[model samples]
Target chain A: MSRGTLALCAAGLLAAILYPLVVRGLAGAGVGVSANYLINVGMLVFFVAFIGQSWNIAGGFAGQTSFGHVVFFGTGAYCSTILHVTHGWNPWLAWPVATAAGALVGWAIGALAFRAGLKGSYFALITLAFAEVFRILANSVEFTRGGLGMLIKADQRPENFQFRDPMWIYYLALALCVVSLAIAWQLTRGRFGARLVAIRENEDAARALGIDVYTEKVKVLALSGAMCAAGGTFYAQKYLYIDPSIAFGVDKSVEMLLVSMVGGAGTVFGPLVGSLVLTAINEGTRSLASVVPALKNVQPLSLIVYGAMLILIVARLPDGLMGLFGRRKSGKRHDA
Target chain B: MLEVRGLSKAFGGLKAVDDATLDVRQGEIVALIGPNGAGKTTLFAAIAGFHTPDAGRVTLEGHDITGLAPHRICAAGMVRTFQITQPFAKIDVRENVMVGAWLRTGERAEAMRRAEAVARQVGMGDQLDQLGADLTVAGRKRLELARALATGPKLLLLDEVMAGLNPTEIAEIVDVIRAIRDSGVTILLIEHVMQAVTSLAEQVYVLNQGRMISHGTPAEIAADPAVVEAYLGHGAAARLARGAAHA
Candidate 1:
């Protein structure tokens, strides 16, 4: 590994270890509800980072933009919620089933799209359409209880994936974020990773060089879907409620894109960095609204800031926030 | 050994390659030459599995490989370089070659060693760390060859590898091609450089209007009246015949 990657990993590890302790310390120091609020924000950051990293496998590393990753997230959320609510199954045990369903769906999508030779914007649009379709199904399905959504009654039990304290949820999100980062790290280093980047660089050249482009793409998409679905389960467990609109909405897809792009696509730590920045901005805006009464009625303040940030990131730092750091002397070539 | 039989491809109403047949014997350097729009590249594309021929079959060592994927064709020990060099521009030269080397070995270190050796063989030893986008035209051409060579192909199809090079660079590439042939890889190259064709190709084939006009030794090809007409006008063909006789 390069020194830069090593440093990033070390920093990530330290933050993961220190985060829970800091939250607990604040609670002990009588910060009370504010400390819990901070824990909630931290958990959101970790969740966004996890989802962003999951999206990175296909979007950043493999150069296949998917505007419908929310399908995996929703599938996972619904799979676990329905199983737990309808069958009284343990949420912890149902988590893996949810993840597997996500992988299967992802594989099916990959096989169909790749076999049909879909790529680039067409691929993106198809995935988005699938998400929309899933959202509609979740809304109307009799078993899913339609638009009313599924709700799991909160109980103070680890087996149920429920806890009265927010720390357990925060820790779970943090652990998943680290795992996602580790997966991304391994991918960018090995032969499989190199082939993915090659495909991203030039699909024709990569094929001519003996790389099986279709299989590699399908594999990455499956892995990415599985990872994102796992995050969906965590979200459902923590929130105890999931509606189709909340789980499979286009807004969720855009958030994943924004997080990874803002951090740095294709870079190992890009998603984590992007998640941190975006989460801070979001929470900061909410605090600003609370402090200034005039901003309360305006609404869309966070959306405006997010739009401006995206413009700046796209226009100035095309490589994401990481591009502002040491400018590596690698060539940049975009085929599209 | 490679054999292409009755390969035909059409784009819309235009026949890009029409029932073309060719062969490359083991350890020999064969040249395919033609005027612009003669379908030399289209033929290469069909054989290399980039384009599925509307009608025909291709075989490597007698294994029928028609309509196979390009990567599968490559895995069968046949690889082709592009006329317009396409390198992974963001990656350094070694990594670009390593992408090909990874076909044979899974280990990064092993791929790196193979890539280094091929880069050195292609006279790009000193430019291992140079980004593909930063290379000169000649350097890019060498990188293209190096990448193909790293794949350990038994039959390498080179498309316009000698184009856009100075005489010195062209001569260097010719030497590299000879060395590649001597190392037991068969070469079927597409070239417009007549000099390189004469110096390097053991046998030469001429294409015109999607048809194989003639095939023979370089000297015979240079002296063929039909070949002369295909290149020069009717008046120049007679002049070339007289000039060939005088020589």
Candidate 2:
């Protein structure tokens, strides 16, 4: 990290810390016109960004490009939900176990796929297949409550991992986002990151250069899976309910992938920027639809715009939105 | 030191490499020369553990590394370069080399330092900041060598480092190879550039039709009729011999 980047990061951190407080003070809590909706939106952006960063770690940095990252996400959600609701385990305790389950699944999948010499599209398709399998299993399984889904009884206590104030959950999301940012930052400066980028660029070359490509890929997927699973736990805690569709949905997978891709897949701040854009579009379209009074739901309007924007991003900005800021110097920052 | 005993590899019905034997002594520079499709790259892959040999052994410093993974073979003190250069295209040259440097040292700073030193050794000192994709053909070739060299290998298997270089570039790389050998890394290179082979190789091995036909000093291998017959068909070799007599 350069002094400029360090200063930028510090400023961004300060801005994030102040955002909710500023919104509450300015708007004075209420409903649609107040800060409440914006606060929720802001919270959601951070949460999605957090999970998207998990996808970015393996898909963007390692070039694993998984289409089924929700497998880990759903796995995490179901593990914690099952343990907390069924086994009477504390959510806090269950979260870690859930995260571990995600990592183990990631490790197993990575070992199976890479060991079989699956590469490129094949590797991606297998992840999608795995996610579908998990989704189906969760749909039919006894402990998961099948299609009915499971819910945590409302116990609004900080110790119970539930919050009376939404601001607290928002802050938690912010903390997770910051930690993930640090992980990405760490990758940019370390040997592990270098090895991953090498594997991403050319696995055969990386192997010939004495990099254990298989181990590195497996390690990255494990790391990615853990981070994603943590997000799953956060999601369940926030919503208090996780059904089969919500937990293992392709929509969440696409959202995670889209945020990373649109922002800047490999960069630390990509998912954050992407989530902000997505939330902004959603709100912007919602307000526009309210004025028009004919739009059935604002979501379709936003989706059209989002779909168009995605095409533009893919066509013009291969490096995502971060490329616009001249962040191509991802290699020059080792001096820090 | 490296040794290969009757290494053979076949893909389905086509025997890509059959019963090939070669050796690189401690601090020696040997050349493997053959026509295109003479199974040179396949043999390099087989020895480097990219391809599993059917019935033979490869020993690096007297340990059997025949069917080990490519990374394990690289760690065991032999690293092979590709005939067609493969660089981390998005990463810069120094970082690309650092990927190999990370093999010995896990420290980022130390690996970067080693990568820089290797880059300089390959005459790529000024091009350190260039992206791997941005390099010219000769630059990519040098990048390949620098990357493999960063691993601190005992033996470097260079697959046509000069395949796409001009004469001057070829001479520079040849000098770089010599410097690498002098600095204590042995080399076993596959070359079509007979000049580089003659100038740099202490011993030359000729492979034809998935087999090693001859092995000797550069002059002796150049004079061998079997080597000529392998490169040119029997009719062409005889005709060339007759033409030489007529001349």
Best by DockQ: 2
> Candidate 2, B113: how far from true, in Å?
0.6
Candidate 2 per-residue C-alpha lDDT over B79-183 given as tens digits, one digit per residue, 9 for 90 to 100: 999988998998789889988998999788898899999999999999988889999999999999999999999999999999889999998998999999999
Q: B9 in model 1: Cα distance from truth in Å?
A: 1.5
List candidate 2 stretches off by more than 4 Å: A29-33, A297-299, A327-332, B235-241
Clashing pairs in 2: none
CAPRI-style class, candidate 1:
medium
Candidate 1 local lDDT, B1-247, one digit each (tens): 7888998999999998888989899999999998899999999999998999999889999999988999999999999999999989877898899899999998877888899899999999999878888999999899889999999999999999989999999999999999999999999999999999999999999999898989999999998888888888667888866788999
Across A106-130, the per-residue lDDT of candidate 2 in tens digits comes to 9999999999989889998999899
TM-score of 1: 0.95
Q: Give residue B26's error in model 2 in angstroms.
A: 0.7
